[model samples]
Target chain A: MKIIRSVAEMQKETLMHKENKRSIGFAPTMGYFHKGHLQLIEEAKKENDIVAVSIFVNPLQFGENEDFGRYPRDEKRDIQLAESYGVDLLFIPTVEEMYPTKPQLNMVMVDRVDVLCGKSRPGHFDGVVTVLAKLFHIVQPNRAYFGLKDAQQIAVVDVLIQQYNFPIELIRVPTAREDNGLAMSSRNVYLTEQERAEAPAIIHALQEAKSLMENEERHPAVIVEKVRALLQQHTSAKIDYVELLSYPELKTIEQINQQVIVAVAVQFEKARLIDNIIYHP
Target chain B: MKIIRSVAEMQKETLMHKENKRSIGFAPTMGYFHKGHLQLIEEAKKENDIVAVSIFVNPLQFGENEDFGRYPRDEKRDIQLAESYGVDLLFIPTVEEMYPTKPQLNMVMVDRVDVLCGKSRPGHFDGVVTVLAKLFHIVQPNRAYFGLKDAQQIAVVDVLIQQYNFPIELIRVPTAREDNGLAMSSRNVYLTEQERAEAPAIIHALQEAKSLMENEERHPAVIVEKVRALLQQHTSAKIDYVELLSYPELKTIEQINQQVIVAVAVQFEKARLIDNIIYHP
Candidate 1:
């Protein structure tokens, strides 16, 4: 597989590929790959003549107080995983390589922002929109894959794509999970052994909420309180928020007659764990 | 030349062109094509395998009180002008075609925006950035031609392209002017016969400032005063602003030792005219 870094070099490669009439499918990610990311690459490879994956741990997306410094990264391991999925190119751009100079803000984010993860992490969606716009320009892919794990991100990206009229199709893969039902995340690596043991509770709470939702229990407040109580049982876990929101718009659901996402974020011993389940009533 | 109205169709056409190994040079304009806009298309035709011109009189860039309703537009005239310049494609998207849904309040605007035309016309730069970004994505040009007549706009576009890592080379064609030296503008249609006759004074003031700087007259305040006095003499012209600013960065230049732009804005009859001259001291 060809490993490219510079945007110009990637554009040149893309131009040649286009000249040869090769269809391109792209999977954009922040490195430290796992089964979740590999699945995306595999899916991309299935649909296009050439599959390219970009590993950019975007600094702009991280909040000032967030875990940007310790975000897990292993380029060697990421490349090995991506190549195994028959990826044709691995785009590994350095922070300076991706952003040679201090860039002017070019993209305008939508208002309301779905306000999911954006509530705790302000300007996060702005960062995501900015970087994704840049990537779309460079890759010029026929289709791009994104994990449903970042449900809020997918919603934001979808709106941006439609609003800006970017020539890309978004293909969302289901959120990959561990055997114990915990959603797989690069940040999960930051949890201490004890915290790791308690992390599964996030998923457990989501499942419990889904079961309650399925039983025709429609009170959003009641569902939230139960999830909050269950999460509070773990001494290491502190509930950041447990709320029921409209699936994609993420607005408050006055009545749970439509699709909804019951999501939870809990602070563990050394990290924050987030998980969610979608249900229709 | 083929005229494309829908963004989807334009993207498809662009993709088909790419697959055929065509290097597209684009000229994005707010219709009512003047000599300046035609020059950009001429440049595009000379440099590219295919030339695409988009004539969109974007509403997003105009303030509520500004002349959005009266913004001149003649698609037939523009198409003829574009075809004369050997343009391969003419993209004429209606407001509904471009924006099916109303845009959110959030938008992109450069930091140094409130210096020239930006200050006079509120939210103008944001509109320019938003529409240009959308056009760039839809057109996906190899190189985009911009007339240097709108000096600050050129700077804003330059910064945005760099920030977004758009795969485009910005070719700044020198500002095209009329025989009497007034910078050609779509708003020129609003000028009355008497107002139009006196409009050349705007260019004359700029030229005088350039001459003074060339002769070692370094005081920016003096230059500002002289230009203001020249425009004030024209009874029909209401001087909006006259200032000497550093080129590109657009910082207020107290002493003209480097490259500087003498920009002026005047309101005559119902039209607002802006023009500038770059001088090196």
Candidate 2:
């Protein structure tokens, strides 16, 4: 595996591969490598001649009060894990390298992005979209991998691709999870022992809601209330949002007549955790 | 010269040229091919192994009262003119073909974008950026060409390229002008016989300001007053804005020490025209 740092070098390498008629698959992440990230790389390896992964802790996605400063970083562990998965290129760009100018460009402006996680952390989606846009242009992948864990992000990115007509096929892998159904997230390391014990409640609530929907209990309001009650069992748990939205659009639906997604976000004593489940009725 | 309508076809053709390790230069414009548009293509052909031009009359850049509905378009004339310059590929995508969806994505959310033309035409820059983003992706040119006539647009696009870290170099071609110094624009067709007669005043004012700056006039207010006085000579012209700003940032500068841009917008009987001159002191 090649460890590339400069955007110009990466572009040159990718263009060579393109000249040889090789399809490059890209996996972008804020590297604290896990099974979920490896799964994305594995999938990319199967579909393309070369795989590229970017690991930059995007500061734009975190608000002033959020964990931008405290976000974890481990280059050694990440490099070993990525090479093990047969990554062709591992991009590690500094903030200055990626953004020479203070990125005054708001490239990821989308409609309805202001809802869901956007409502709580304003400009978070903008940051994600901006970084993703930069990565997309840098890598010029035939297909890009994004985990369904950030379900709202996938929706916003979908619009970004369609609106900008980026020549990329966005392959959304299913949400990777832990043994107890807690979605795999880098922030999961922040959970204290007690908070970790209660973290499963968030996933449990999602499972219960999906089960209820599958069994013909479809009132979105009732499901939201029940999920809120379940999370209330944890004393330190603070609900950010508990929504049962139409799949992909993230809009509210009274009943699940078509594809639907049940998603949740909560702030515990340790860190914020988000997870989701999609179902068809 | 090849005329292509489908993005897939163009991409395939471009890929073949890429396999030869040929550099691509692109020029994106709205149709009604004038000498200015032809000059860009001619310059691109000299610099690149492949020169691609996309003519799209983006509806997103048009205001409610703007001339989007009546904008001049002539594909036959455009193709004939492009052929004269030995163009590689001419991309003329239909509106339905360009926008398969309503484009739920808004690309122009840049700070200070709303100051000049952005303020006059709400969401105009958003559309411009959105369409340009699409074109950038589809054409995937090594160096993209933009004219200095749309000075504000060039600044915005420069930010777009920088902010997104798009792997393409931007070349700002000097503004092509008429013998009378009127900046070439497709919208010049909207000028009536009387409006066309008085149109040279706009350029005259810019020239007067340029002369003042050349003679070391440093005060912005004085320069603006001189330009405004020159503009007052045209009985049919209604001045919209006249200001001296720092280049790219568009911030008002009290004194010109470095590069500065003098810009003006005027409404004639049936059309609004914008022109600018960049001066370095």
- Residue pairs in collision within model 1: none
Q: Once model 1 is optimally superposed onto the true structure by TM-score, how far is the C-alpha of residue A137 displaced, in angstroms? A: 1.7
For model 1, report DockQ: 0.61
TM-score against native, each model: 0.95, 0.92
The sequence of per-residue lDDT tens digits that candidate 2 reaches over residues A158-268 is 887776768789999988888987889999899998888888888888888988987898788988888888989753678998888887877777677888878889988
lDDT of 1 by residue, A117-194 (tens): 778888888888888888887787889899988887887888888888888899998889999777998888888888
Candidate 2 on B179-253: residue-level lDDT in tens? 987888888888998888788888888998999988988999999998888888763788888888999788887
Q: Candidate 2 has which clashing residue pairs, if any?
A: none
lDDT of 1 by residue, B213-237 (tens): 8888999999899988878885468
Estimate the Cα RMSD of every predicted model relative to the unseen true structure: 2.0, 2.6
Candidate 2 chain A, run of 10 with poorest lDDT: A103-112
